[model samples]
Structures are given as C-alpha cells and as structure tokens.
Target: MNSAEVLSSDLDLVRRSLLVQKSEILNKHMEFKNLQHSSAKATDEADAVVQDLQDNLNIQLHERDQFSLLLIDKALSKFADGTYGLCECCADVIDVRRLKARPLATLCIACMEDQEAPGKHLFQ
Candidate 1:
C-alpha cells in the first residue's frame, strides 16, 4: 500500500497496544487497591509490617502505571491530531525501534537525551 495507508496501519497497531496496556494497568491498580484495603486487617505485628511494605510497593507500582496511562492518553491524542510518529520536541519522525520499545514516546532519541542531560544551564 501507500505511505498514508502504512502510517494508518501503524497508528492502529499503536492504538491497540496502548488500549490493552491501559486495561491491564487499570486491572492491576484495582487489585492493588483491594490488597491495600485487605491489609488493614493484619493481626500479628510481623504481618502488619509485611503488609505495610507490600502496600508501599503496590502504591509505587500503581503510580508508575498511572503515569504510563496518562502518557498513552496523550499519545492517542497525538494520533488523532495526525502527529503520532513525530517527535514532540523536534517535529521529526521518531525511530521505529524506539517507538516499538516505547509506543507512547513523544520524543526522538536525540531530543530525549537532550531533555535528560544533566548539568545543563538554563540560559545555555
């Protein structure tokens, strides 16, 4: 097919993947919520401590999942706006490998590295 068809197909694939991931993350967050509530019934001192640690871990995991879900949502919006495969910072096409690795990515490797670079002065 043509380039437009190929891009449409790729965006469809990305959309499907992100929807599946979003569902899975929501399910896990629900499970974590249930676990957190159930842990309040821990009786033994050791059990309570263990439960606390588990709760903390669950909270951290849920927060990361939430952030991922938000990114996926933003990516979906980009797709709607016909800018799915383009880098947000430089407006160039993002690498396919990077998109495959992180479908929700909005930046290309160079832009991402620049954003992540440490010790850069604000003025320069």
Candidate 2:
C-alpha cells in the first residue's frame, strides 16, 4: 500500500531469495564433495589427465560457490541488522529494483561504478 509497506515486502522477498540461494549452494557443495571423495581410479595416463582436469574444474567451481555463500551470508546479516538494501558506501537506501536484481549487492550503483572506474585510486 504505502512506500514503507512496499519496501518491507521487497526486503522480505529478498531475504527469502537469499536463503534459497544459500541452500542451493550448500547442497551443490556437498554433492561436489561426495563426488570428489568417490572419484574413480585412473586406468591410464590419458584417464589420469582427464581425471586431473575434472578435479581442477571441480575445485574452481567449489571456490566460486564458497564466494557466493560468503556474499549471501553478508547480505543476510545486513537484514538482521536492519540495514539490508542500504548502500555500504553512502549509507543510503539502495534502489529496490537493484536489490531485486542482485540480492547479494552491497554497494549501490553509483558507488559500484566509481569503484570500478579505471585510474581511480582508492588511497589517493
């Protein structure tokens, strides 16, 4: 109905979405761990090379999932602190649209752009 109500609803949705993502990542991580532990023995050099490649790919995927989990956890913590959807850099309320699009986003668009800008020194 009102802006506050809408924002609350949006935040609730974001929280649910983040939880779902966290669960999915955790499930996938567990499955990958099981697969790694049960990997088939290499029969020959070619098989060994393929197994190595597959192992390397799995590690990379696991690392990526771990990073995603971290971001999701941070976002969920923000909700607990009553600061979800607020820009970390400006302390301003991030646009609800942006939050919907990227539930793990910490910085608002302007701040993100500035951070990504080339030749922009942070220490200067």
Candidate 3:
C-alpha cells in the first residue's frame, strides 16, 4: 500500500523541522543585523561580503526547506502505506529510537551499512 498520507505521529518530525527553520530564521536575522552595521561604512568589499553572505544563506535555507519537505513527504507516504517506521529497503522493522532521531531515513541501518561498505569484489 504505497500511499502518501503521513501518520499523526509524524507531526513530531514536522515539529523538529520547524525548530530547524526557526534557527535558520534567527541566523538570517543576525546576518541582516550585521549587514546593516556594515553598510554604514559601505566599502565595496564590505558590500560584496554582505551580498555573498545573503546568497549563501539563501542557498542554505533552500536546501534545508527541501530536506524538510522530503522528510514530511516520506512520513506522509508511510502513513498512507501503513508502513510508517519500516525500512523501505529489505522490509525490516526500523527501531523506534531510529525513527525518532531520523524520520527521513528510508533504509534500515543494515541496509545503510551494506550500501556504505565497499565489498571486496568492488575494490578489485
């Protein structure tokens, strides 16, 4: 049942993502404050630095948003499929602790280890 409706419990994952978003917003506010102070003296190099920081922050926030969305979507799908907290690969049951820590994870630790470990044959 590969459905896309997340379980109610997955809202905890969304909450965690929201916390990350809040931190990012705080960082952006700090950066804006610094930019405001720097623009007072407004040298070309300083202007460039502020612009670069803004660009970097934008990219970072975009990536974070994308990651959050991916996690949420995974949770939603699992809810629909009645496979929430189960490993997508190998069909093994995922530990509750693992899910709490990493709701976005699709693979069980065993599967993850298999992927990360280079087999001897592959090294040859």
Model 3 lDDT per residue over 79-116, tens place: 66778767777888776567667766778898888787
Error of 2 at 109 (Å): 1.8
Off by over 4 Å in 1: 116-124
Model 2 misplaced regions, further than 4 Å: 120-124
lDDT of each: 0.83, 0.90, 0.67
Select the stronger candidate by TM-score from 1 and 3: 1
Residue pairs with colliding backbones in model 2 are none
Q: Which wins on TM-score, candidate 2 or candidate 3?
A: 2
Best by lDDT: 2
lDDT of candidate 3 at residue 75, scale 0 to 100: 69
Q: What tens digits encode model 1's per-residue C-alpha lDDT throughout 1-124?
A: 9986986677688778988988998888888778777667899999989888887888788789889989988887887888888988999999766786789888999998988888665747
| Candidate 1 lDDT (Cα, 0 to 1) | 0.83
Error of 1 at 51 (Å): 0.9
